[model samples]
Target: MGEAIGQTIPLGVGVALSPLPVVAVVLMLGSRRGRSNGPAFLIGWLLGLVVVGSVALLVAGALGPTDEGEPAAWVSWVKLALGVLALLLAGRTWRDRPTGGHRPELPSWMRTVDGFTAGKALGLGAGLSGVNPKNLMLTLAAGAVIAQTGIPAGEQAVALGVFVLIGALGPGVPVVGYLALGERAERMLGELQTWMVRHNAAIMTVVVLVIGAKLIGDAVAGLAA
Candidate 1:
């Protein structure tokens, strides 16, 4: 469990520290129906993550038994694949970066989010957490790591639950603050949103590159050991 957690921390952080989701949630908090939609969005977001992670874990478990002592070769291969995907995604993110000192445009749907029903908000949350390429891959990678760790099923579930909670924290903090501090958080969240919009690409570039290398390196080390 400890090993799994260590390996998954970055993936969790990557999912949690994503700026756009937080920005969108914060924007929702400013809407008239924020009270219902914000929490609903959060629940939906967490459910999406849990669903992906759980599926990966289940699949990994179903792959049959392996040598008890040595790590499975497929685990390393999976990590390598995930690493390559991350690098490719990093390149794409770098390319999509807004040139010059301009904010990246928010999606057209975001403009209308303020009026969204709870159902729409929930759908949006699911789309961002489950369907977004970056988050989906990270969650899968994290799940694969846990599943491959040779831990008991019960422990694996605990680790996965922890991963989901940590990954949700980044997007969850704003909602907590909004509920607690009310309007006071608006200005801070707004500033954060602006900075995130401006630097999101660059930030993701570093994150994906570093974590990608780590995954590849860890996989290679496990295979060699």
Candidate 2:
């Protein structure tokens, strides 16, 4: 059980930390109004990630395995694939030069901001993953990992619920990590508007392929060991 649980963590992280959620946060938060709504946006961004992990738990629990093989090869592949994906994504993001992809850019005007509502911002932030294909694929992969572990659906659900809350923290650490950045950073991301349109598509595609390779790579390495 411990080994199974241990194995699931990377899968969960892979699913949780993909660029879709991060991009959504960056995109929506990059909006002109997003700077003013920083607090709300942050809250919502986190809630949205929670929704994603929750989905993973629910799906994994729902599709409980009836028969299974300890496919160490597959698992190792998954790890390698995930790692490659991360590197690919990092490369793309770096290529696009978003500075801080997970964090948004704030505009000069919104720098010294006024009152902002957390509720509305949260609403938009929650929608970050709504149309994101990356989020869907990542979440499904995680669900597969969870269901394959032989844990009861109920327990898997619980674990995923917890993971989402924790997972969001990984990408969102900056929101809390740097206070001076605040809304300004979120708005400035808009500077990438032109760049995102021109380069983000290819970057995103590379991220997907790379992560898949990483997953497969990890699986193979484990099998070798």
lDDT (10s digit) by residue, model 2, range 68-108? 54433444454565556555665665575544444345334
lDDT (Cα, tens digit) per residue for candidate 1, span 45-73: 99999999999898877773377744578
The segments of candidate 2 whose C-alpha lies over 4 angstroms from its true place after superposition are 1-36, 67-117, 152-158, 165-171, 180-206, 214-225
Error of 1 at 185 (Å): 1.1
What TM value does model 2 have?
0.52
Off-target runs (Cα >4 Å) in candidate 1 are none
lDDT of each: 0.85, 0.52
Judging by lDDT against the true structure, name the best candidate.
Answer: 1
